[model samples]
Target: MTDLDYFDQFDDEGTEDSASKRDSLPDWVSNSNSSLAAYQAIQSLYKEKMQYIRGHSKKSHYTKKGSYHISKSEVARAAGLAKPNAIFHSVDYASKLTKELNDKNALLVASKEKILLSRSSSIKDLSKKELQSELRGRDRYKEISELKADEIVDLTLKRLPLDVKRQLYLA
Candidate 1:
């Protein structure tokens, strides 16, 4: 077959697959004549996009941006709607979904910030030796924590003056 014909065959197959997907949709979505179905589709698409943003799904077509929030246009395109404004046809439903999406995005940002803060605080608490070991790709924290009390006492005493060591042992 010619190159054009070959590509056209794939295009036709894609349409058929999409048609099958449409047929598989629930009755409320596939058979409805109302705009509610469109809103439902948009809501579901938004949720799917959020799943991609949250790294819960492997199939991601959306570009990675600094903001985690999904736009109305993105949802409309995912739902195969002609215009982004179509998502807002049902104002109440659209507003509710938008609020929920914003809340979820805020929570995700907050959680990430909390994780970064915890990591920074833990790093700051590390001793110079532990930090150097960590930079050398060694996990010193576990080894240090696992050190025996007697070993720690010996290590501490080894740094003291002879008189101090003698006095400490006498006491």
Candidate 2:
């Protein structure tokens, strides 16, 4: 066959596949003929990408990458749009999505900081005598159990508060 005919055959198959995909889309996406519909389509694709990145989805279409970040062009391409800007044509929708993503990242960072702070603060909050006893206890446990230094530290931290409470009750 001529090159033109060969390519035409693939094009016809692609059209049929795309037509089937279009039929499977949501009723609103298939029925509407507006820019809003395009935006909605891109939004849904974006959520799917996020879900895949977060390991919440097992869809083969979204390949896992080293970086979790998703871009505007990726969403646009997934929605079969020619231009990424077309997806973000609605300023309100674009800004709202951006704000939501930022807020989620901010909350994640805040919670991580809180956990680190609590861990360090627990060690620092102990009095000098308590701190000394904690270290001595860790060493004793290490020697007795032949455990690694890191494991001993973890064990001591887990037991510290309870030990303090017992000492308080005794005194």
Candidate 3:
């Protein structure tokens, strides 16, 4: 049968409620199907409706439980940002967070490059005292690097949702 034949079959066997599409399928299919074809066959409707609601390209990839699958409307509703007559749009928080990430990325690159260049260059050429002094400098650099890494980690932890922070404390 042609593709249209299968389309007609789905339209006939379908339930009226919309959430039954394949994206919400149990994980067993993902491991067992071996075909990687659930989204096209079952979840396509949710993807299509979601795309139409949000203007996603018709051909965009939709992964199950993956990064692209995040639903802003659902998250917003859960966060209690949904209004009886409106949708919440919070830009400042995301913008500030993006700037922070960009800053961290740039700083980490600079730090890594500095450390690599300092360590990778030959140390054999230095006199004993100079070599010892350079070793001290390397120790200092390593300490600073650890501090910077800690700073990054602590900042990341600060951004964790409240429950995660509480669990971290209990652990």
Best by lDDT: 1
**Best candidate per TM-score, number?**
1
Candidate 3 per-residue C-alpha lDDT over 1-171 given as tens digits, one digit per residue, 9 for 90 to 100: 999887877655556454565556543344243212322222343443444434322122222323233243433443344431222233323433233334443543444344434543356534577789988999987875778777878767877899987887932
lDDT of 1 by residue, 1-171 (tens): 899887775555445666676775544443444344554555575565455445432212233543445566666666677776755555435565455546655765554444434543367666687788777765566666789999888777777888886887932
Worst 10 residues of 3 by lDDT: 33-42
Is candidate 1 or 2 superior in lDDT? 1
Using lDDT as the yardstick, the better of models 2 and 3 is: 2
What is the lDDT, from 0 to 100, of the residue 96 in candidate 3?
34
Which segments of candidate 2 are over 4 A away from where they belong?
A: 1-34, 53-67, 89-171
Ten contiguous residues with the weakest lDDT in model 2: 57-66
TM-score of each: 0.35, 0.29, 0.20
> Please, what are the lDDT tens digits per residue for candidate 2 over residues 30-59?
334433455455556545644544542222
What clash count goes with each model? Answer: 0, 0, 2
List ranges where model 1 is wrong by over 4 Å: 1-38, 46-68, 89-94, 100-154, 159-171
Identify the superior model by TM-score, candidate 1 or candidate 3.
1
